[model samples]
Target chain A: MITLTHVHKSFGDNHVLRGVSLHVPKGQSMVIIGGSGTGKSVTIKSVLGLVEPDSGRIEVDGREVHEGDRDAFLARFGMLFQGGALFDSLPVWQNVAFRLLRGALKRPKEEAREIAIDKLRRVGLRAAVADLFPSELSGGMQKRVGLARAIAADPEIIFFDEPTTGLDPIMAGVINELIREIVTEMGATTMTITHDMTSVRTIADRVAMLHDGVIQWEGPISEMDGADDPYLAQFIRGRADGPIEAVR
Target chain B: MSGLLSPVAALGRSMLALLAYVGRVAIFAGATVAHVFRPPWYWREFGWALMQIGWLSLPVVGMTALFTGGALALQIYDGGARFQAEFAVPSIVAIGMVRELGPVLGGLMVAARVASSIAAEIGTMKVTEQIDALVTLSTHPMKYLTVPRVVAATLAVPVLVAVGDSIGILGGYLVGVTRLDFNAAAYLKNTFDFLELWDVTSGLIKGAVFGFIVALCGCYFGMNSGRGAQGVGRATKSAVVTASVLIFAANYILTEVFFAA
Candidate 1:
C-alpha cells in the first residue's frame, strides 16, 4: 500500500498541490482524474520521488521514504510514462529488460532477453519486434511495448501516467483492457492518472477526481455517473457551463 | 521612454533566468560526477558512449590535426625564410603542435562533432521524455545517461590528443620533406630533440580537462533542454560554443600552471 499524507508542492509561486492526501491499498486500482495542469502528474511524481514535495510524507509498504532512499523505494514500483519513454538507442527487448540487465537484479544476457520476450508476448507483440527500435513501431505498438517494460520486473506497485492520452478510442480501450488484465493477474497496487472517462470506466476500481489541487470526490467506478457533487456532475457530463467554469 | 525600457527589462530577466539555469546545470553536473564512482555502472550504456563519443570521433580529430600540422609547417617555413632562420621550422612545428594547436584545435573539432551530437541526442531524448522514463523506472537518469558519456570523454580525449600530436608531427614531416627543400633526417632529429615530455604531458592533461568540459556542457544543456526542435537546436549550439570556450580557457590555465617559466 502507498499513502500520501499532506503533500504540498509548489513551483515558485504556483502552488500546484495544496495539502493533497490519497491512499491506494494493495491489489486495488485507484484512478485520479483531473484537468490538465492541475497537479495530477505532480502527485504521481511526488509518490515516485520524481517531484520532491515541498512538505509531505510518502510511505510505501510501511517504509517511510525521506530524502535518501528514493531509488530503493521506487524499485518496488513500475511506471508507464505519458509519452511511453522508451530508450531509442536500445532495441525494444533491452528497453524492457533494462533493470534486469544491471546492478542487484543482474541476469545473464540470454536469460534477460528471454524474460523480455515473454513480457513482449504478454503485451501481444511478436518476438521479431523485440529486436527492433522504438522508432520503428507505430504509436499503439509503442504503448504496448511501454506496458511490457513496465511489468517486466513484476513490480508490487504500478503507476500509469496518462495512459490513453493520444490513442484512438479503440486503441485506448485495448490499453485500458490490458492494464486491467495485468493489474488483476499480478494483484498489484495500481494508481492510474488520466482524464479520460472511458479509461476510468474500464480500468479503475475506484475513481478520484482532482480539482483545485484537492481530491474533490472519490468512489467506486460504478458510482461515478450517479455522483451528486456538482464538479463531478459537470466533469462527467462534459458541460461548458458549471461551477468549475464559474471559477475561471 | 518607459515603454522602451520594457524590452530591456525583459532582456535582463531572460539573462538572469539563463544564469540561474546555468547554476542549476553546474549542480547537476556535480551530481553526475558524484554518482559516477558509485556502484551499479551501466556497462552497456558505457560501451555505447565509448563508441559514440570517442571511437567514432577519430576521423575528424585525426584529419584536423593532420591538416593543421601541414599548414603550420608551411606557414612557419614561409615566415622563417623572411628572418633567415628557416632552420627552426621543424623544431617550431613540433613545439607548436604539441603545445598549443594539437590539444586546442583537437578539442574544438571534438566540441564541434561530439559535443553537438551528445547534446542533440540527449536533448531529443529529453523532449521525448526518455529521461523521465528512466527516473520512473527506478533508474537515476544522470547515472545511467550522463555519467557514461562523461567518463568516456574524459578517458578518451587524452589518448586522442596523443595520437593527434603524433599524426600532426608526421603531417609536418611529410610536408617538410616532400614539398619544402628540407632534409628528412635533420627535420626528424629537430622534432625529436625539440619535443619534451612536459610538452606532450601538458597537452594530454589539457585534453582530459577539455573532454570533461565538452561532455559536461553537452549533458547539462541536453538534460535542461526546452521542449521542441528549437530547444534542441539551441542546446546543441550552446553546447558547442561553451565547450570551445572552456577548452581554450582551460588550455591557457593548464599551460600556465605546467610551464610558467
Candidate 2:
C-alpha cells in the first residue's frame, strides 16, 4: 500500500500542494482527477520522491520514505510519464528493456531483448515494432511502448501520469484497456493522474478529485456520479458555468 | 519613484530565479557524482559515452593538433630567423605544442562538437520526458544519463590529449625536415630531447579537467532546458559557449599552477 500524510509543497509564494493526503491499497488502482496545474502531478512526484515535500511523510508498504533514501525507495516502483518519454537514441526493445540491460538488475543482452519483446506482446504491439526508434512510431504506439516499459520490471507500485492525454479516442480506449489488463494481471498498486473521464471509468477502482492543492472529493468510482459535492459535479459533467473558475 | 522601484524589484526577481536554477543544477550534479561511485554503475550507458566522448573525438583532435603544430613551426621559424636562432625551430615547436597548444585546442574543438551534441541530445530527451521515463522505470536518471558521460569524459580526455600531442609533434617534424631544410634525424632528436614528462602530463591534466567541464555544462544546460525547440537550441548554444570559455579559463589556471616561475 502507498500512503501520504499531510504533505505540503510550495514554490515561492505559490503552494502547489497544501496539507494534502491520500492512500492506495495493494492490488487497487486509484485514479486522481483534476484540472491542469492543480497539483495532481506534484502529488504523484512527491510520492515517488521526485518532488520533496516540505512537511509530511510518504510511506510505501509501511516503510517511511526518507528524503535521503529516494533511490532505494523508488526501486520498487515503475512510472509512466504523461509524454511517453521514450529515448530517441534507443530502439523500442532497448527502451522497453532499459532497466534490464544495465545496472544492478542487468541481464545478458539477448535475455533483456527477449523480455522486451514479451512485454511488447503483452501491450498488444507487434514484435516487428521492437527494432524501430521512437521517432518512427505514431503517438498511440509510443504510449503502448511506454506502458510496456512501465510493466517490464513487474514493479510492485506503478504510477501513470496522463496515460491518455494525446491519443485519439479509439487509441485512448486501447491504451486504457492495456493499462487495466496489465495492472490487474500484476496485481500492482497503481496511482494514475489524468483528466480523461473515460480513463477514470475504465481504469480506476477509486477516484480522488484534487482542487486548490487539496483533495476536494474521494470515493469509489461507482459513487463518483452520484456524489453531491459541487466540485465533483462540475468536474465530472464538464460544465463551463460552475464554481470552479475557467481562469485563475 | 514607483517606476524605478518596480524595475528594481523585477531585476531582483529575475536574479533570484537564476540563482535558484543554479542551485537546482548543482544539487542535480552532486547527486549524479555521488551515484557514480555507488554499486550500480550503468555499464551500457558508460560504453556509449566512451564512444561519444572519446572514440568519435579522435578525428577532430588529430586534425586540430596537426594543423596547429605545422602553423606553429612556420611562425616560430619566421620569428627565430630575425634572431638568427632558426635552428631552435623543432625544439620550440615540440615544447609549445605539448605544453599548451595541443590540449587546449583539442578541448575547444571537442567543446564545439561533443558538448553541443550532448546538450542537444539530453535537452531533446528532457523536453520529450525521456529522463522522466527513466525515473519511472526505477532507474535513476543521474546514474543512467550523467554518470556515464562524466566518467567517460574524465577517463577519455587524457587519451585524446596524448594522441593529439604525438600527432602534433609529428606535424612539426614534417614541417621542420621538409620546408625548413633541417635534417630528419636532427629534428627528431631535438623534439625528443626538448619534450619533458611535465609538459605532456600537464597537458593531459588540462585535457581531463576541460573534458569534465564540457560534459558537465552540456548535461546541466540540457536537463535544465525548458520544453520546446527554442529551449533545446538555447541549451546547445549555452553549453558550447560555456564549455569553451571554461576550457580556456581552466587551461590558464592550470598552466599557472604547473609552470609558474
Candidate 3:
C-alpha cells in the first residue's frame, strides 16, 4: 500500500506536480493515465524517491518512503523501465538476474542464472535467449525481458512505465495480458503510467487520470467511462481539442 | 551605460555558472570517494573498467612513449652539439623519458581513449534510464559505475605509465646507439647512473593522479549530461577536453611538488 499527500514538484519555471495526492491500496492494479508531460512518470518516481518532491509525504506500508534502509526499502519493489533499460554490457540473463547476482541479495552465479532462466520462461522467453545481449533482442522481446526482470525477485510492489509503448498491437496485448497475470499471481501492488487506453482497459483494476499536475478524476475502471470530468472524458476519447490544451 | 554594463553582467553570470558547475563536480567527486570505501563493491565492474582504462590503453600509450623518446633523443643530441655537449644526450634523454614524458604522454593517451569511451557510455546510459534502473534495483550508481571506474583508472594508469617509461627508455637507447653513434655500453651506463628511483616514483605518482582526473572527468560529465543524443555528444567532448586540461595542470602542480625546492 502507498499514499502520497500533497506532493509538489517543479523544474525551473515549469511546474510539473502541484499538491497532487493519491492512494493505492495493497495488491491492486492502479494505472495513472494522462496526456504527454502530465507528470505521470514523475508521480511514480516521486513515490520511489527517485524524484525528490518539493513538499509531500510518500508512505509505503505506513512508513515514509525515504525512511529506513534503502536496500531494504527497495527490495520490496521492482520496476519495468520504459526502454527496458537493460545494461548493454551484460547478457540478457545477467540483466534479468542483476539484483540476484549482486549486492545484499547476492546468490551464487549458477543459482542466479537458474532463477533468471526461470523468470524468462515465465515471461514466455526461451532459455537460449539468456546468453544474448539486449541489443540482440527485438523490441517486444526486450519488453518481455524487462517484464521478466521486474518480477525476478518476486517483489511485493511492481511499477510499469509505458509497458505497452513501441510494441505492435498484438505484442502490446500480450504484454498487457502478461502484466495482468503476473500481478494476480504475485499479488503485488502496481502503479503504472501510460497514455495507452487499451492497456488501461486490459490491466487496470482502478484508473486515475492526471492533468494540470493533479489527479482530475479517479475510480474503478467501470466508472471511468461515465466520469463527468471534461478532462478525463477528453483524455479517454483521445481528443486533440478539449478543455486541456493540445499543446503546452 | 546600460549597454556597457550588459557585457560585464553577462561575464559575471558566466563566471558564476562555471563556479557552480565546478562545485557540483567537486561534490560528485566527494560522493564517489565516499562510496568507494562503502561495502557492496562491484568487483566485476571494476575488473571491466581496469581492462578498459588500463589494458586496452597499452598500445596507444606505448606508441606515444616510443615516438616521444625517439624524438627527445634526436632533439637533445642536436641541441647538445651546439656546445660540444653531444655526450650528454643519453642522460638528458633518460631523465626526460622517465621523469616527464612517460607519464604525461601516457596519461594524455589514456584520457583521450578511456575518458571519451566512459563519458559516452555512461552518458548514453543516463539518458536511456539504465542509471535510473540501477537505482530502482537498489544498486548505487556511484558504487556500480563511478567508483569502479575511478579506482580502476587510478590503480591501472600507474602500471601503464611504468610500462611506458620502460619502453620509452628502450626507444631512446635504440636511437642513441644506432643513429646518434653513441656506444651502447656508455649510453646504457649513463641512463642507469643518471636516473634516481625518485624520478620514476614521481612520474608514477603523477600517473595515478592523472588517471584519477581522467576517469573522474569522464564519469562526472557523463552522469551530469543533459538529455538525448546531443547531450551525450556534449558530455563526451567535455570529458576529453576537461580531462586533458586537468592532466596538464596536475602535471605542473605535481612537478613542482616533486622537484621544486
Candidate 4:
C-alpha cells in the first residue's frame, strides 16, 4: 500500500538516505531494522512527508503523498513516535481522541471521549487512566496511551517509530505483543522501525535490514535468520567485529 | 595578505547571515499572518493563548508601570523644584507614563515573561515530535500553534497598555498627593488636561506592534529550534533577547514617527 522509489535525502554533509527503495503491501507488517543514524526514521518520515525527500517519489494507495489535500492524505494514517509525543497539556483521552476531535474526522465531544476510552481499553489501559496527563503516567503506560492513539481513528496505515525504545524488557514484550495483536485485528498495513530483535520477532511478518543508507536484505521473518547476507548476519548476531563497523 | 583579508571576509559573512536571518523571520511572520486569515480557525487554542498572553500577564505589567510612574513623579517633582516648576509634576508624569513608559515597559515585561515561555513550550514540543504528531493528525502546527498566539498578543497587548497607562497615572497621583503634598483634585485635573487622545492612541499602536514582535520572535525561534533540552534553552534565551531588543528599537522608531518635528 506504500511505496518509496530511489528516495534520497541529505542534511549538509550527511547523506542519510542515499537511494532507498522499498514497498509494503496492504495488511502486512514491515519492520525495518537498522543501526542508529542509518536513515530508518527518515525513510518513514519521507513517506509521511514529515521530512521531504531531496528527490524521488513516495506513494500511498497509488497516489503521490504530496499531491492531494494534506489533511485528507494524513487522515488515512497514524503514527506512534519514539517519545510518545503526547500533548503535554492534554489529558490522555484528549490525546487519544485528538484527530477525532478536529478536522475532517471530527466527531462530537462525547463520542470522541467514548471512543478514546474504548481505544484505551483496547491497549490494556483502564478507563480511569484517561483523565491523567502524559507526564503523570509511567513510561510503559505512556507507550500504551500512544499506541491507543495510533489506533484510535482506525487508520488504514500506522507507523510505529521505535515502539520499544526506553522500555523495560517486560514492558517492551508487552508492547510488542500488543502491537502484533492489534495490527492483526485491525488488518492495518504497518511500518515499524526498530533495532529491537525481540520486537522484530514478535511484530514483523516481513523484515528489511537497512544499512549504509540502503536496504541490505529483505524477506519473510522466517528467512531472516538464515539469510546469507554478511551485513544482515553481523546485525542479527549483534557481533562487534564483522562487516558492520563497531565504530563510526 | 590573507590575514589582512580575513577580518573583512568574516564581517561580510556575518552580514550575509544577518540578512538571511531577517529574511527567514519576515517570511515566517508573513506566513503566520496568512494563516490567521485562512479558515479552520482553532478557537480553543486561540482562547488559551489569549489567557496566557493577555490575562495572565496583567500582574507583572501592572507592577512595572506602577513603580515606574511613582519614580517618575518623584524625579519630576525634585527636578522641577530647582527651577520653581514643582507644580508641573502632574502633567509631566501623566504625559511620560502615557506616551513613553506605558507601552515600552509593558511590552518589555511581556517579552520577558511570555516570549521565553512560548519559545520553551514550542521548542520542547518540536524536540519531542509533538509537532510532527500534529502534522500526522491532520493539523497544521502553524495554524494550531502560531496563529492563535500571534493573533492573541496582537489583539491583547494594546489592552494591556491601556490598563497599564491608567494604573501608572494612578500611581503618580498617589505619590503627588500623599508624599509630594499636592492637592489631589488639582493633580488629577492637570493629568487629565495635559493628556490628549493622540498620546494614548499612539502608545496603543506601539503596544500592538511590540506585541507582534514579541510573539513572532517566540514562535520563530521556537519552530526553528534545534533538538534536545539544550536547544530549547537556547531558543528561550534567543526569543527573550530578540523580543526585548525589537521592543526597544520599535519603540524608538515609533516615537520618531509619532512625535518628531
Instruction: Give me the runs in candidate 4 sitting further than 4 Å from their true place.
Output: none
DockQ of every candidate structure? 0.65, 0.54, 0.88, 0.96
Writing each residue's lDDT as its tens digit, candidate 1 over B25-83 gives: 77987898899989768887888888887888888889999998899999999999998
Kindly indicate the candidate among 3 and 4 with the higher lDDT.
4
Ten-residue stretch with the least lDDT total in model 1 chain B? B132-141
Report how far off residue B34 is in candidate 2 (Å): 4.3
What is the C-alpha lDDT profile of model 3 across B1-261, one tens digit per residue? 999899999999999999998899899989989998989888889999999889999999999988888888899989899999998888888788778998889999999999999999999999999999999999988899999999999999999999999888888888999899989999999988988999899999999999999999999999988999999999999999999998999999999998999
lDDT of 1 by residue, A1-248 (tens): 88888989999999999888888888999999988888999998888777889997888776766656666666778889888999988899999998888755669999999999999999899999999999999888999999999999888999999999899999999999999999999999999999898998889988889888888898988899988999998887788798786455
Query: What CAPRI-style quality would you assign to candidate 2?
Result: medium
Pick the winner on lDDT between candidates 1 and 3: 3
lDDT of 2 at B186: 89
Task: Between candidates 3 and 4, name the one with more favorable TM-score.
Answer: 4
Backbone clash tally (model 2): 0
* Residue B49, model 4: Cα distance from true site in angstroms: 1.0
The CAPRI classification for model 3 reads as: high
Question: Taking the true A–B contacts (Cα pairs closer than 8 Å), what share appears in each candidate?
Answer: 0.74, 0.68, 0.88, 1.00
Cand. 2: chain B TM-score: 0.91
lDDT of 1: 0.88
Candidate 3 lDDT tens digits, A1-248: 79989999999988999888899999999999998898999999998889999998999999999889999999889999999999999999999999999878889999999999999999999999999999999999999999999999999999999999999999999999999999999999999999999999999999998899999998999899998999999999988788988863
Model 3 chain B worst lDDT window (10 residues):
B90-99
